[model samples]
Target chain A: MKLMDKLQILADSAKYDVSCSSSGSSRSNRPGGVGNASLPGICHSWADDGRCISLLKVLFTNVCIYDCKYCVNRSSNDVRRASFTPDELCELTIQFYRRNYIEGLFLSSAVIRSPDYTMELMIKALRKLRHEYRFNGYIHIKSIPGADMRLVHEAGSLADRMSINIELPSVSGLKLLAPQKDPASILEPMGYVRERIMESRELVLYKKPQPFVPAGQSTQLIVGATRDSDLKILTLTEHLYRRYQLKRVYYSAYVPVNDDRNLPSVNTSPPLLREHRIYQADWLLRFYGFKAGELLDEGHPNLDTHLDPKCDWALRHLDQFPVEINKAPLEMLLRVPGIGYRMAAKIIRARRVGPLGFEDLKRMRVVLKRARYFITCNGRYYGGIDLDSGLLYQLLSDKTDSKVMAGQISMFG
Target chain B: MVYVTDGSFEGILTAVFEAFRNREDPEEITLGGDFQLSMTAGIREISTDTEKSDRVWRGVESKISKESLENLYMAYLSEHPRVGLYIYRYIKLGLNIGRKVEGYLQHPDVHAIYDLSRRVGSEAHLFLGILRFKKLRNGVFYACYEPDNNITQLITDHFASRLSDQAWIIHDRKRDILALFNGEEVIFTSGFPGIDHEDCEGEYEELWKRYFSAIAIESRKNPRLQRSFMPRRYWRHLPEKQL
Candidate 1:
């Protein structure tokens, strides 16, 4: 088949994975190398779906042996199958890099013939791109679930980042939809990658550091795939972060592509708002001092779809409000509804100079509309209304009209 | 009094020097050729004096932090109409308050300088991703861009470090200048007009266009969000936006 024909089929099949970040690795260009990786990733283009297309995300092939019910390229599905030769894939990447089309290659594949076979093909393409073509750009490849440990290790050394998708949030869900896959198959490789990364750090202290996934590893969890509650997902995510030390946990809203008895109805719209709320809560977990248990519990098994997680948390714990912004610590400042990391840092810096008032916060570009209810600048409250939860919820939620809410939700859907 | 400069960064600094040396508050500062005839205020044309500009820059460097120095240069690159006077006020305030002046966000001049500098900096950062190169017949990649701010010089190091093994030219069509990186060193030159270059014939461009279209999920097509990130103003040079 033609290269364009294969790219359309393979890239379309790979689009649902939705982990396209190319940041966190600063691989410099060698003396005769063609590219370098930026510390903060660059988005080459914004797709029509409003997602950043940072990497040339494509599958090595769309032919699978295992019939995962949720996947587009599952074995039973009668989709067109195609695969790229190692040389063709490397040439495509170099040509696109020369034209400034992408940061690097994000290569994934279906279980073509066997896990080991698929991984070997991916490693061959990466080796040609890195060694033969002398390309030093960011390359993110997938670690096949049941690939050989040696093949996984070799692929890790060549790629900047690697990901092993958990596919579903729970073990029972995996059993119901993808019986051929098991949790151990996924976690074993993740454990190995983490160990090697730590060993590489230690080796760096003694010798020239060899890059083994310098951008770190990340995984994706399919939201709304099964009847998994937000609590269950968060619990699993927390475990992954603490145990595996993963860089990111991307949550892709389950878009119903296959008509399976186990999956959601084909007519159901993806849970984009839920995915967004999960991202917000994820930010709180990673940046803010909030733990997963603090954000959601047995009483509230799901995030408030209308209100953001921060605002919801603030409203629930009103006793924490009315904190003096001038004297509050950085952690306290970050808990405010509208205050972000950058704004909190600014407040900390500016307050060191002198006592700041509400005007100072406004001039510093702080979003006072939501923060005023929770903060007191210089012992004075600027939130004119009384501290009523119902009133505040009405005010905050009413500001976003239905049309604007739809626009915002669909932007990251 | 109004002060007119020669439209270079040094000329603006020189105008500030002249304003401070004369101890006169200029009502306005503009580029040399942009002086409007005023009915009452006197106009002074300041030549580009490297010695005076360097002294003023040294004073700024010693008084403020290195970050503040970058802010001043970025604000000058913004090319806003009243940015000269705003930067002058910012420098005067910074000199008085020492390095703590950056935290004085309440000051109008400080706030204006910060906003202008951020605008230029963000635009330059955006082009680091948005700029696209097309292979020419001579094996030198060429790209053309028309950014709102004068950021051609600011983004050279980024591409130079990334595409270090290839020869490339980034032509700023609006400013009529080109940044040419020939594998090792980068140099600025006058922009050249259309050349007799043939487009490379390959399936890679076609493959890229296909991948670009295929990756977007059809269920969530949001052109407004796409425009917010990659605005319509920059669509002219993007290969995916082309046929």
Candidate 2:
């Protein structure tokens, strides 16, 4: 098919993948390549979900042999099918790059003939972009489950990053939804790639060859598809970080794109807000010293729909509140519901010079509304109006909404 | 007495330097009223001089980090209140702190500059993505934008290298500046004189608008969020806005 037709079809299909980030890579242009990737901020394209749009995420072909229940491109589903020749895809990317339409390409494919065939096609596309077209822009390739180990290795060398979607949190869930794929098929390639990246990092002193994935590996887990608890999902995410040294664990709120007797009805949109909360919690876990158990449990397996996970946790663990602003450690300050890493850094810097009182905290742009009730700096407390739970909720509700009010103040603060 | 510029970021930065050299406060300066009247006591126009500008740029570079330098560039792009004067005083204040103030990335002045920079940076990034090109009969390519901040200066180099094979004109209609790139070189000009408004064939624009509308999922129509990303002020120049 023509490249634009393929782009329209595959980008539409691949929009549901929801891990379209081109951040965190620092690859520069080679001698004859068309582009480069900036570290601090590169270009990204936003999906319908309003997340940062970075990658030109698209599938090579929507034609598949496997009938994954949630995918619109499954074999059983009657959908328009398109595929790109390596040259066509490379030319389209270079044109788009020249026009500033995209930063990098996030190329994935459904199983066309076999796992190895699909993997080889993807690798060939990347190699064409790299060697034939001399396009050095960031390329994120999807690692096909059950692909040959050697093909996966070649994919890493050509691409900046590779992701193999775990699809489901558990083996039973995987079997129920995507019976054609199994756990080992996905995990094995990821394990091999992870080990290679680690080995390359270690050998950097003695040897100069960097492995296939410089941005390292990332994977996606479908949220709200199975009855998996938030706790279970977070635990799996934590393990992915611990075991695989994965760079990111993306949670795609499951949107049923195909009809199946076993799958949930496609009437309801994915709980996007819930997915957003999970991401917030995920950020906290990765950057803010948060544990999985701290945010969820067996009984309360779901996050509160109204309040954010951190705020929910803060209310549940109120004793940890009213943390003395002048004395609390950086970790504890970061745990405060309103305080993020940026705010915490500000507090640390401000406190270094002198003692910070309520006024100083206010001047430093702390959300004194929510924070005042939770902090006592030098015996001054300007929060918790009436100290009644009902009143506190009302006061907190007004103050906690920093989104709209963030504009009233200098957003730089 | 001090004189304020017209709230344009460059005007503010120019005034800031004037205030510091004359040992005056920015708050006392007003754009065309009492301050200008008082300044008539014996004032001079700060002509845009290359050496003076380069020296000021050097002061900004030495006093602040590269990030802050970019921030100052963005701050200069804004049409905010006292922005020019604030930038001028900011540089002088930055110089006095020796170097410790450079780490004060959260200072209100720093934050303001940072915010402006992000807005300009975001617009530059978006123009890279959403910018649509047209083939004029003259064989010149053209794209028009109404960016939230004056970012036409920022995106020229990107377009220059990317479209080296073709001559292109990127016009920031809101700022009345055009980055014109011939096949060989690029220059920032005030305006395009020969281009006809009716030359908009409107077919490609219609197709782009249709594609935009089709791609926007109704299931996730968060206009609030969309507004947060692409503000309505820029809607006037957007092809989708014509619809």
The segments of candidate 1 whose C-alpha lies over 4 angstroms from its true place after superposition are A398-413, B35-38, B195-203
Model 2 chain A scores worst on lDDT over the 10 consecutive residues at: A404-413
What local distance difference test score does each model get?
0.86, 0.69
Q: Model 1 residue A320 lDDT?
A: 79
For model 1, residues A82-163, the per-residue Cα lDDT tens digits are: 9989888888888888888889999999998899999999998899889999989999999999999999999999999999
Complex DockQ per candidate = 0.66, 0.23
Could you give the interface RMSD of each candidate, to one decimal? 2.1, 4.8
Model 2 chain B: lowest-lDDT 10 consecutive positions: B27-36
- Residue B82 in model 2: shift from native, Å? 0.4
User: What CAPRI grade goes to candidate 1?
Assistant: medium
lDDT of 2 by residue, B14-64 (tens): 555666576765443343333435533445444344555565667777766
DockQ of candidate 1 against the true complex: 0.66
For model 1 chain B, the run of ten residues with the poorest summed lDDT:
B194-203
